[model samples]
Target: MTLPTTAAAPPSAPPRTFSAVLVANRGEIACRVIRTLKEMGIRSVAVYSDADKDAKHVALADTAVAIGGTAPAESYLKIDAIIDACRRSGAEAVHPGYGFLSENVEFAKALDAAGITFIGPGIGAIEVMGDKIRSKNHVMAYDVPCVPGIAKPGLTDQDLIEAASDVGFPLLIKPSAGGGGKGMHVVEQAEDLASTLLTARRVAASAFGDDTLFLERLIRAPRHIEVQVLADNHGNVIHLGERECSLQRRHQKVIEEAPSALFESLADGAAHRERIGEAACNAARSVNYSGAGTVEFLVSDEHPDEFFFMEMNTRLQVEHPVTELVTGIDLVEWQVRIAAGEVLTVAQSDVVLQGHAVEARVYAEVPERNFMPSMGRIVALAEHGAADATVSGQQPDHANVRIDSAMRDTLQITGDYDPMLAKVIAWGEGRTAALDTLDAALGRYTLLGVDTNVEYLRLLINDSDVRAGHLDTGLIERKLPSMEFRHAGPRELIAAALTLWLERPGSAFAGDAWKVPDAWRVGARGAWTATFGLPGAGTATVSVTEKDGSVTAAVDGGGPVNVRVADRSGTGLVLEFDGGLVTYAVGSAPGAVREISVGNDGWSCRLEVLDRAERLRRMLSGIQREEGAADPEVRSPMPGTVVSVSVSDGDSVEEGQVLLAVEAMKMEHQLVASVAGTVHLTSKPGDLVKADQILATIHVHVATEETANTGQNTDKEVHP
Candidate 1:
C-alpha cells in the first residue's frame, strides 16, 4: 500500500470511497463525528454498550450494534467487537473519537490488520506520540522545548525520588500512555513522593493498562495552551492556532477558549502566535503526523514567549468545538478526508481566526464538594443562546452558541464512564462579548434530576477576574471558596406550597381548579400548615389561609406575605409570592414523589409531601436518626467497585485514616474515618457497592487503650 509522499499529491485514480464509518467510541464526540459523517453523505454505524442502548448517538446513526457490557473494557475498548460490528454493518472506516481506544495503538494495529482505515495518524505516529516519554524524545529533534524532568518509563520509587530532587519540588508524576488528567499527580514535598507515585502508577495501570510513569517539572502558574494541527497524507500540515485551557479542576479542563487571552497580553502577540503555530507544525512534521491532532504546551503566564512542549494528543480534543467556531473548519471532516488520501485545501497563510470563542464543559458533578462526579438520570434540560444572542439591542454579531451533547431528558448518566454530560460553546467578536454570550447561554441552560455544575459555571462566567482575562490552571480551585451553593429561596418555597395545595383531591380546586379563583380553601379563610421537604436540606413549613381572591402565607414561621394565583394546572403552577411572580414545572410519577422546577432561577427540587401525622412521626424518629448519627459508619459516596481496603474488621483506626478507596467514573475516591475508633469492615476490595452503601462501621466505644493513642475524647460526637 503506497502512501502520499509529497505536499500536493495528485488525486487518486479511482477516488477512494468511504460509504460508511463506524464510530468506535461513545458520548459527545461520537455524536459529533456522526454529524460530520451525515454532512458528508456517509452512513454511520454506532456501537453501544448495554447501558447505552437508548443513547442519543445510537439513535442518530443509520445503524447500531450492541458490543457488550457497561464497562469500557468489555465494550468500547474491545477491538475484536468493534471490528466485528464494522464487518456486520459494512463500515469501511473506524473513527476513534478520543478516550477509550482513541490513543490505543493496539486497536489501531488491529484495524490495520482487518483492512479498515483508521481515521487518525498511522501506526508510526501513534507509536511515537501515544507514549508521553516517547513523544518527548521524538520532538526534541525538531527543537521543541520540553519540560525539564526525567522521561524514563517504569522508574522505581527511589529513582523517581532522585529525579524529583533534580527537577526540584512541586513537580508532576504523570502516566506516559494516556492523557485526560487521569493518573496524574503533583508532588509538593520529597517525603510525599513515594506514596503519590504508587497511587499514580496504580491509577495509570487501572485506567490505561500501563503503569509506566514520567516525571516533569511543574510550571507553578503556567497557562495550558495547545495548538491544533491538521495534517493530510500529502504532507500538508497547517495549524489552526491555539486554545487556552488554563481553567482546570483536578487537572481536567473546565473551560477552554480559542486565541488565548494570554497572547492578547503580549506586545509582539502576532509574531509570538505565528512562532507557536510554526512550532506545532514542526512537531507534527517530526513524526510525519497525519489527520487532526493537538500539540499541547505549558506557556509561562508571566513570559508569553516562553513555552514548553507538554505532549501530543493523537486524537481530537474535547475542546475542538471552540476551535471550529473560530476557524470555521470542521476537523472531523478533515480527518475523514485526510484518511481518504485528500490534500489540504486551506494553506497555513490562508487560515484565519474570525472571532473569540469559549467552551464550558457541562458535567454531572458537584462543584462545592470537591467536584465529585454525580450520576443519575437527567429528568429535564433546557438550553438557550444557540445561534448567538442579539446583545445590547444591536444587530446580532455573527457570533453564535453551540451545544454538543449526548444527553437528553430522562437519560441516565451512568457511572461507567466520564461524567461530562455536554459541551456549551459560544462565539463573539471580542472576549467580553463572547463571555457575555456564554453567561446568557449558561443562565438559560438548566439540567435537573442529577446534580450539575450549571450554576457553578454561570458563576464562573460572571466572575470579574475571569472577565478580566486573569486565568491559570488553578483558577477554579482558588475561586471555589467564594462560589456559594444556592438553595430553594422564597419563590421556590411558595411554588412548592402552591403545588401541594393544587394536588389535594379533597380541596375545592382539585377538579375544576382553574374556574375557582380561591378554591384552595381551608374552611373559608381557615389557616392550615403543610410541611414541605427540601432536597438536601430540612423541611420548610408553609402556613396558608385563603381569603378574598388571595391567600396569606408564611414560610418557616416567617412574617406573613400575600400570595395570589397567577395560573394553575394539573402539571404546573404560576403564583405571585410577595408581589414577585414565579412558575414551577411540576412532575409526578406513580409514587408520591414530586419534582418541582422554579422558573425564576432554575432551582429544581424533588420534594416528598409530609402530612401532619407523617411530620410528627419523622420528628419523633429523629431521636433514632441521631443515635445512628452519633456512631457513624463510613459509606461509599458513589456507586463503584471497591478498589482497596486499608482496614481490617478488627483494626484500630485513627480519625482521618483512609478506610478504603472506591473507583467510580474513571476516578478514585478515598473514604476516611471521621472519628477515632475500631473499624468493622463490611465490604472488601473488589466488592461492588452502591451509592451511600455502608462499607465499614467505626465503633467509638471500643475498649482498646491502643486506639486512644491520641488521648482525644472517645465520647460520641455528631458525625460530620
Candidate 2:
C-alpha cells in the first residue's frame, strides 16, 4: 500500500511553523508529541493533574502547569483551565494528543476564538465527523458505502424502536460521539434492547459527555480497518494506507498492524488499497477537513472485499505509531505544518509502506483477573534495547524495536485515566518477522510494581490463528478463557527465600541463634529453617544445610537437593540448583517485601519471609479458626465507587449471582455471590469503598446441629 510518486514543482514559500506548542494531554501520548516538538525546535508545554505531578511527561516538557484534580473532568476536560495554561505558558498553539479534548469541537472553537492555533482538524470537521450519526449521514450523501441502519434527523424513541425492528435482531447501539468502545452494546434479543440502551446512554454521557446514540446492524465477526488521512487547508488530502485493528478485548483494540494483512489476500491488492485510500480522502474532502484525522470502516469477515463507513476520528489515533513506522513520515510534524497554513508536501503517489510494523499496548492491568486495571508505584523498569542504546531515557535506535512510553523507575501509576502505560512497536521486512520481534521485545521488557499484559500479548502474537492472520474483533474475548496465569514454582520460591537470607541487613543468624559461618562451623554444619509466604500460594518452610561440602535444601515434604551458591552481587544471586544455573534479581524492602525475578525469563514474584516460629504459630491459629468457621464476608477487590447494588439485605441468592458493581478506571466489575446463602449487604450504591472493605456477608446453611446453631461453615471467599 505505497503512495504513487509523481513529478511536481517546488513550493513558492517556506513551510509554516510555530514558536511554542502546549500538549493538552497526559501519559505516553503527551510524551510522543513533546518529542516531535523538540525535534522541530519548538518549545513544549505540558499540563498535568494532581496524580501526574511527577510524571515523566511533566519532566520532559520545557514548562509544566497544574490544571486541577486527578479525575479527567476536573482537569484535562476543563477547556478554560487548558486555555489559561496556554496563555500563561505563552504558547501560540495547542496539540490535543489523541484523547481528552482532542476531538472536542468546543475546545477547538475556543482555541480559535482566543487566537491560538489548534493542531488538528477544523471545528466544522470535528462537529460533523466527531458524531457517528452525523458522519455516516454526511458520508452517505457522497455515495460512500455505509452500514445500513437508522440515523434520521430529529428521530424519536419510537422511531428508533421502529428502526431497530427493521434492522432485525442482533443490532448494535453505540454513542454517536464515542470512540474506544465506550458506551457500545450489542443487543442479541429484543427483551434486553431497552435495558442495554439505558446503560449505553448512561455510559456515553459519563465518558463523552454525550448521551446521543445511534442504532446500526451488528456486523458479527467483523474486521476493523481504518485509513489515516492527512489534509491541508489548500484542499489537498491523502491517505497513509490502513491499520488492522481487529484484535480487541471488550470492544477496545489491544494489538494493531499497518499495511493490513487483508490487503495481501485481495487479487488486485494495489487497486483495492487505492479504492479505500480514495474513499478516505473523499471523506476528508466532504467535510473540508484539514490536518490529521482517521476514517474507520467495518469490513465483513465473510466478504473481505466489502467495507462500510463507520465513523471518522477528527484527531490523531492511539495507533498512529504503526502508520508512522511503515510510511516513515512524521504525522505530528505534518499536523503542525498543516495547521500553520502550509501546503501538503507529500503527495498521494509519494506515500510508501516500507516494512511490516506491529504495535501492542502495554497496559497496567492484569489479564488473569478479568483484565482489571492496576495502580501502584513502578518499583522497577527495564527495556532491553540494542547494544548501542542506553538503558535509561535514551531512545533505542534498534530498527526492529521502539518503545513509546511515559514510564520511569519509581514512577506511580494512578487510577485517574486510561490504564495503558506504553506502546511497544516492532518492525521487520515482513509480517512474520515483525511479529517475532514484537514477541521477543515483550519477553525482554520487565515491569515490576503494577501488573501488565505483556505475557498475554506474547501468547496472542504466537497464537496459531493470529499468526495466520485470521483476525476479527472478537478474537481476544474468545481466547481470554484459555489463557492461564503462570505462577512461581518451588525452585523460584527457594531462590526468593535464599535471597532474603543473604540480603536482609545482618547475617542469616539472629539474636541467640548460632553464627553458622563461625570459625568452628567451617567443617561442621546444621540445618537452618526459614519460612516464606507466596501471598495467595500459601506458606512453606525451607530447610537449608551444608553437608559434605555441598549445600542441601528441602521444602515441606520434598526431597533434599544439592545446591551451590556460585556468586552474590547487589540484589542478584547466581545459584546452581536442580542441575541448572539460575540468576535471581531481588529487591528487598524492610520487613517482608521481597521481590525476586528469575533470570531474563520475566518470571517474578513478591514473597514474604518470616521467622519459622512465627509462621508456625500463625498456621496453628489458622487451623483453629477453620475448625470453628464463621460466615465469610465478601470484600471489595480494589478501591472504587460502587456503581450499582443489585441485591438487598436478607436476600437469598445463589452462587455467582451479581451482588453489586464497582467502577474503577472507567471499567465496571460485578461482585458476585460466593455461595448459596442469605446475603447481608454492608455497602450501598454510590459508596466509595477501599480495597478489602466488607461489601457483604454471606451466611451459609448447614445440616449439623452445632453448625446450624453457630451459623458458620468452612467456606473461603474467592478473591478476583
Candidate 3:
C-alpha cells in the first residue's frame, strides 16, 4: 500500500536543525535511537536513573545525565526530570524511544511549550490515537475498517449492556484508555456481561486513569497484523508493508515478521496487502500523523482477506528493525529528518519490499515455568555481533542479522522494569531462509547467570505449524502441552560439579573422609562428590575422580564416564567427554553464591551447588514428607512486590486457592495454596519479595501413630 503524495502542507516555517538530541528512554531502544543520532552526526544525550548509571546507553552517549531514582515513576516516567536533562545537556530535540513517555500528549505539549522539538507525531495525533476507544472510532471516518461492536468515549456499563445484544455474544470488553491486553475480557454470554464490564471499568480507571469501556466482537482465531506507516508534516505518507505478530503468550508478542505470511496465504494475497496497507495510511492521515507509526489490526485467521482496525501506536515499535530490514529504510533517521521539516523524498512507488525479515524478542524469563521473569547480573553476554559491539552498546546491523540490545558484561538485570533484554532480527531471500537465520542467531546468543527463554524460542520457531505459517492467537497455548522443554541433564550436572570442583583449593586431594575413605588410596584417587540443585528438576550428586591428570565423572552414582576440559575461557568451555568434543557456554555466581549456569545447543540451565546443610535439609524433607503430597510452602515465582493477599493468617483454605499476587517486571503472578489447610502469611501487599521466597504456608494436619488407629488428626508446627 502506498500513500498519495498529495495533501495540504502545514504553514511554511523556518527549518529547524538539531545539533543535539536526547533519548528519553532506556535499554535497547535508547541504544537504538542513539546509534542513528550518532550516524547522523547529532550529538546524543542519554538520561539514566540510579539503577542505570552504569547502563550501556549511558556509556554510549556523548554525555549522560542523572534524572532521579531507580524505579520508573521516580525516573523514566518523570517528565520534568527528562526535560531538565534535555535543557542541561543542551539537547534541542528529544526522541522518546517507544515506551516510557513516547506517546504522552502532556509530554509533547510541554516540549512544544519549551520550544523543544519532539521526534514524533503532532500533539493532536497523540492525544486522539493514544486512547484506544477514540482511535477506533476516529479511524472509521477515514474509511478504515473496525472490529464491530460499541465504541464511544463515555459508554457506561448500562450503555454497553443495552448495546450488548446487537454487539452479539462472544464479545470482548476492552478499556479504551490503555493497551497491553490489560482491562480486557471476553464474554461468551449476555448474562456475564455486566460483571465483566464492572471489572473492566475498574481496571481501566486504575491502570489508565480512565473508566471508559468498549465492546467488540471477538474474532475467532485472530491474527495480529500491524502496518508501518511513515508520515511527514507535508501530509505525505507511505507504508513499509505489514508484519505478522500472532505468536504471543499472555498477550505479549514473542515473534514478529514482515511481510506477513498470513497475508501471503490468501487467494488474493497482494490485494489483501494493498487494502490493509491503505487502511493503515488512512488511519495515520486521519490524525495528521507524523514520524514513524504503526497501525495494528486484527485479521481473522479463518478469513484472511478481512482486517479490522485495532489501535495506532504513535511512536516507534519494538519490532521496527524488521520493517527497516525489508524496506532498506532506517525509521529513526526519517523520524529525525521529518522532525527537521524535511519533505518526503521517497515516494510510494519507491517503497519496495526487499527480501524477508523476522525478529524474535529476547526476554529474561523461564519459559517452562509459565514464562516467569528471571533477574540476575549478566556474568556473561554474547550476541549476534562482534564482541566489542556489546561493550559499545551500538546497534549491530550485520549482513543478515540486526541486533538491538543494551546488554553488556556484568550488567545487573533487575525486576524493576520490563523483562525484554534484546531483539534478534534476521533477513534472507525468503521467509524460510530468514527464519533459519533467526534460529541460528538465537542459538549463538548467550546471556548467562540468569534464566532466559532462548531455548524455548528455538522450539517455537521449529514448531511444525509455525514453520508452515499456520499461526493464530491461540497457537502458543494449544501447543504448550506438547512442547518438550529442556532442563539440566546428566551432562549438565557433571559440568556444574566439575566447574566448582576444579576451582576449589586442593582439588587433587579434596574429599570428605567419612563419605569417601577410599578417595586417598595410592592406586586410584578417591571419589569427590558435589550436590547440585537444578531449577525445577530437583537435586543430584555428581562424583568426579581424577588420576594422572585425567578426569572421569558420574552423576547419581551412575557408571563413570571419561571427562576432561580441553580448554577454558571466559564463559566458554571446550570439553572432551565420552568420546565427543563440545563447546559449552557457562557462567558462575560471584563470590560464594555457589550457583553455576551452563548451556550448549541453546538448551541452558542455572544450577546451584548446595552446601552440606542445605543438602541435609533436603534429605530430611524427603524422608519425612508423605507420599504424593504437595509442598506446604508457597513460594514466589519471581522477585516482585506483593500486590494483594487474599488469605489472612489462620484462614482455612482449599487446594488451589489464590493466596496472594506478586507483580514483577510488569507482570502479576498469583500464588496458590497447594493443599486444603489453615494458611499462614509471610509477605503482605506492597512488600518486596525475592524469587523463591516463601510468601505463605498451608498447614495440613497429619495423623499420629496412635491417632491413626482411632482415625484422629493432629497438628504439628513447622517453620522456615
CA lDDT, every model vs. true structure: 0.80, 0.79, 0.84
lDDT by residue (530-585, candidate 3, tens digit) is: 88887974789999888888888999999888988877776787788767988888
Question: lDDT by residue for model 1 over 1-720, one digit each (tens)?
Answer: 111223444666645769999999898888888988888899999999999999989998999999999988899988999999999999999999999898888989999999999999988998999899989988989988899999976688788887788988899998988698778898889999988888888888888888999899888888999999999877788898899999888899999998899887777888778878888888999989999999999998888889999999999999998888888888998899889888887777667888899999988887766777777666556665332222111224323878788877778887899999888888889999899888777776766667788878888877887888888888888899977778777656766677667665545466644454443444564666667766544677887777666677888889888888788764456777667876665543323434444443434555556766767776775655655454467878789999988878888789899989998888799999977877889999899898779999887654346447877655542223
List model 2 lDDT by residue over 533-650, tens digit each.
Answer: 6534367777776556677778885888777778776545688986789776555444244434333355455555665565777688577556545426778877788888888898
Could you arrange the candidates by TM-score from highest to lowest?
Answer: 3, 1, 2
Best by TM-score: 3
Q: Where does candidate 3 stray beyond 4 Å? A: 1-3, 6-15, 154-166, 188-211, 386-398, 505-524, 701-720
Q: TM-score for all predictions?
A: 0.90, 0.88, 0.92
Which has the better lDDT: candidate 1, or candidate 2? 1
Cα deviation of 147 in candidate 3 (Å)?
0.9
Off by over 4 Å in 1: 1-14, 385-399, 505-537, 543-549, 567-573, 583-631, 702-720
If the candidates were sorted by their lDDT against the true structure, best first, what order would they fall in?
3, 1, 2
